[model samples]
Target: MHRSAPRLSRILACAAVPVMLVVAGCSSDSGDKKEPDSSESSASASASKKAEPTVEPAKFAALPDPCKSIAKKTVTSLVPSAKSKSGTAATSSDTSYRAGCSWNGLDDNGVKGSQYRWLDVGFTRFDSDQSLGSGAERARQDFDKQVAKAKVAEGAKKIAEAPVSGIGEQATKITYDLSKTKEDFKYATIVARTENVVVTLTYNGAGYAGAKTPSATDILKGAEKAAKEAVAAVAGTESDKPSGSTAPSEKATDKEDSPKSSDKDSSDGKSTNRKTSANKSSVKKTS
Candidate 1:
């Protein structure tokens, strides 16, 4: 019986070895509670590493001043007796993105009768938006919209549209006749896109007191001249910025767009907006 006690004790000790081993394993597992947290952090880091630029940045940072877009001499030629030679500026919540100017006058000749002229110019600028796309693309979309708007001008007759060159990236001229204020007015609108800016200009004139009506051809020519000057003004704004002031992202975008821009402009080998001459602009008379 005494020998049986020793054997039984040995059996109990053998059983305790497994229980101790189980306790040790549980302790090890509890001490490693941070393992899941480490894995989660690695997952977040991996996601961050995968993030990259999805779209090109905008090219132009700001828009040119609308009032000064044209030269004084050009304004005088377009409007001989402008109510405000400086032009009336359009109201805008944000001038940086949208602006306009207009001028109107009557050149009265006692016997020959009075010549009434009205001119208006407007500008809109776009920015690079991830949801919307690059600035130039946005501008192009707006350009199309403006062209469509001009095609259906109210009370317009003999409407015509034709693509024009030597003005901007791409431009279209729309001409028509409208009777307003008891006078038949000739209207010409030039809708143009320059990089990321959109220029819309309307020129119209009438004959008063049985005066000879202005030629539709003359209206179109005047509209084209003013549109070119406005486009040039937009281009001049870029160089006005301090040297090296351009944002790095904008520079990157410019680099990306250069090849495509060159492809479109290779025919002229120059930027259309940059071809501006010194000229002036005026405002429109709604009446």
Candidate 2:
């Protein structure tokens, strides 16, 4: 009887050993299948990440000096007795991207009422932006905005809008009458675009002390000519220079802000009021 009991106990112990091994093997397999692997986790994270969007490249790389944009003879023809034949430069924090110049003078005739004339030209450049689109596209947007602004000038009368060709990629002429300084002023503004740059040219005149008001035809013609030159100047800039080149050589201009119109002064640096006007459109944008 004692020998049989020992045999039974040995059998039980062998069976228990198999049970323990099977349970341990099942637990190890479950863990291996459930836990994530490092390589697989990295790949999953990468797949879920978002990619950045692409944008088109810009065309024009730089802007021209606004004062030197128009030819000397052209300036003289536009504003005959200009305060500065060299043009009064508009103040710019960044001359590379933005610049402007203006001329205003009263061509005083001994007895005839003085002829008032004012001419101003401004340039703006847009860079390619990932969020804002391409430079040319941005310039086009601003060009539209400028045309719209010119169409709605304050205190303007006899408003006229026309398409002008042969100036730039595209151009528009806006002519109107404005009453300021107790004078009837004829105004012509040309809004033009050449790739990534926008050129805005304004030419206006008034007859003071009974001088004849400048014909809108003549003002529009002069505006178109200056605009053509200003647009061409944009193609001549050097884009690689440092940013924020200021216009220290330029004097005060109306688009810099507003003009304090005065009638007389001969080639002096100070901006005297004018019998003729260069720029005074409060609606004009400098940026």
Superposed by TM-score, candidate 2 places the C-alpha of residue 67 at a distance from the truth, in angstroms, of 0.6
Error of 2 at 19 (Å): 10
In the predicted model 2, the residue pairs found to clash are 116-275, 116-276, 117-276, 117-277, 118-277, 118-278, 119-278, 261-273, 262-273, 262-274
Give candidate 2's error at residue 56 in angstroms: 1.3
lDDT of 2 by residue, 148-264 (tens): 999999999999888999988999999999999999999999999998889999999999998888898998888888888787777555344444333322222222222333222
Candidate 1 per-residue lDDT, tens place, 4-38, comes to: 99999999999999999999999999879778889
In candidate 1, position 86 carries an lDDT of: 82
Candidate 2 TM-score over all chains jointly? 0.69
Q: Which stretches of candidate 2 lie over 4 Å from their true place?
A: 1-52, 238-287
